[model samples]
Target: MKKSLVILITILLSAVIYGCSSSSEAENADNNTEDKPTLTLGQTNWTSTIVPTQIVKQILEDMGYNVEVQDAELGAVYTGLSTADVDIFMDSWSPQQDQYMEEYSDSIERISASYEDAGAGMVVPEYMEDINDVGDLKGREDIVNNEILAISEADPAMEDLQDIIDAYDLDMEMVNSSEGAMLAAAEAKIEEQEPVVLYGWEPHSMFQQLDLKILTNEKVPEIYGDTSIHVTVQNGLQEKAPEAYNFLSNWSISIDDMTEMITKIDDGQNSEDVAQTWIENNQDEIDNMKSN
Candidate 1:
């Protein structure tokens, strides 16, 4: 009887020790997760980057990560990342941005390709189907009021548009304004069912908010081709925030999908609401991306 009691006591002691170890390990893991630094993302003033960056911020926050976005000039934001002031950005337009990245190759690392293809052009609502390419704008002075609604005068898109205008000998004059002005003008024209042309690109929410079509530029096909967009992180992001880095590494998004998310925001839905809505709908897919 004493032998049996001794064996039972041994079994109970082993069980208690194992349970304590498991609980202690779990608590340590939880504390490690909570110790991760708050992530800061940087985006340029370009509107397309705003919505998508917000989506990432919201997702990270939803997963219990603290995140914030800093919107600044293109150069400033890139330089910020190079200095490790920013954690990550997923809105880079490559080929255009490649040379800039080259400058910071040592400090910043291209962790993953977020988008495989990108394009830009003069865009009009789908109703303007009667007009096909950039050259078509040459003769349609009355419809467009001899104006090409453009982003800020400092934007590279303005220079590119000027090149197209000169190449096509377009009669339309470039009206440089803020992205907000361009979108507002496009919105008014869209509401009136009138023809309007604005400098636009793929992966922007504007495409989602309006039934728009990109005008082909046969003469300048070299200017806008399929550019790879990537998620860039400061050096050692993986070591600093392994889980967050891992989640961002595999978060691939198509232009169309980004467009949908952006459109929801452009339509005045709160960015957090839109991101949360997307996360709720795609929980399974997001989980798959984060899975080991």
Candidate 2:
């Protein structure tokens, strides 16, 4: 009876040990799904910037890659990529952001076109028929409150805008406010069908949510704005994480879809939730990139 009791105790102890080992292995496998090759995404603190960055971040996380996004001024984002502190940045608006890009040209590598021919520069209500050109605002300061609603003070574009204003000898003042402030001011003006112009960019929800038109940068098209909000990766990103690098290189989005997504996101929807929903609805697009 004593020997049988001892044998039973040994069997039960062995079973417990085996069960724990199996559980540990299962946990490790689950963790491995999200293990190494973590991606560091850098972004400027703007809705347009955040949307695509979060979208890609979520996509990578879904693909079992770890992602961490660090937000900073546009200049800092570029600096991060230059220093390899950031693995990738999806929206590098050229011509518009040429000044920032100029600094890291040698240290960074552009991997893909996040959005081809994306718009940027001053924007105004379509009803402002006379305001067809950026220079039109020069003499019409009274209607626009002598204030151009601009993004935060740190935006490198602010210098360009000042240059534009100075070049045109405009009597307008740029109100250095947050993006939300600018949008709110724009919304009120639009509601009253009043004239308002704010620093605008395409692939943003403003196009979908308002009857706005981009003020032509005829004054300095060559030096001002163009397109191709390209995806940029740290120089060694491809070598360090080929899967992520490939996915970003193959990624593409229609301007229409991006604008619509932005509109939804601006309507108080969570960005992650919106992006996940976008992925589900556009699985073909995402899947196609994956295979490529």
Candidate 3:
């Protein structure tokens, strides 16, 4: 009887000790998670925005951060940053986005240019020989069915396009569409050697697969001229997340490289997988970004 009681007591004690250890381990895990910095990234609804934002999110996660991405329109992105509802934005075009910065100057700040001299403006296929300038399209609106292909209305580019129309007094109407749909329409036009004018920007896959030309007219002030894409964050990010701030301060990717990734992503590959592959292939570059 005594021996059986001792064995039973020993088993109960062992089970209690095991249960306590497991509970302690779970509590420690929760503590560790709580200790990590949680960051919110404000992502604009554009593939260009999606690509870099994911890359940065993954890099920060690798650096022990709890990162969350929140999608919003360009204007909402600025609002979120200003109010500190969002922590970072990886793709803000300089000078082009200067108005937003000026408005939120007190609450938001720019870290560095992710890529420089990014050309953005209206674009047309190389086959459109006669339609070389924006003014050339003033009277030739019938050629493109009096339509200018453009991305979402949520994009600030659409507003700029509207301003251009008002400035140049072009009769053509701006057609609103998603980037993928606009590209598809552009591709169909290109395949048939038809004329297509649409919003285009560098560090994009469209430039790689399609032979297009950016049009310029001195008649109106240049809105999309060469602009640097910047990494922007809320005002206190540098102090709140010093490590992340340093990494972003050193962030940059070649336009060619970004275009390649965009091409692969457009071809149906996963964005996270593409980013991971790029990170693996460019360890030295990533290391530098993480350092400063």
Tens digit of lDDT per residue, candidate 1, span 186-226? 89988999889888887787776777888888887766667
lDDT for 287 (candidate 3): 96
Given candidate 2, what's the lDDT at residue 103? 77
lDDT of each: 0.80, 0.83, 0.87
Q: Quick one: ranking by lDDT, best first? A: 3, 2, 1
Report residue 259 deviation for candidate 2 (angstroms).
Answer: 0.6
Tens-digit lDDT string for candidate 3 (163-234): 888888888887888887998999999999988889998878887689888888567656776679999999
Q: Which tens-of-lDDT digit does each residue in 46-121 have in candidate 2?
A: 7777778888998898778889999887888888999999889888876667776777878897778877777777
Number of clashes recorded per candidate: 0, 0, 0
User: Distance (Å) between predicted and true CA of 167, model 2?
Assistant: 3.1
Reference-based TM-score, model 2? 0.85
lDDT score, candidate 3: 0.87
Query: TM-score for each prediction?
Result: 0.77, 0.85, 0.85
Q: List the residue pairs that clash in candidate 3.
A: none
- Residue 30 accuracy (lDDT) in model 1: 88
What would the TM-score be for candidate 3 when compared with the true structure?
0.85
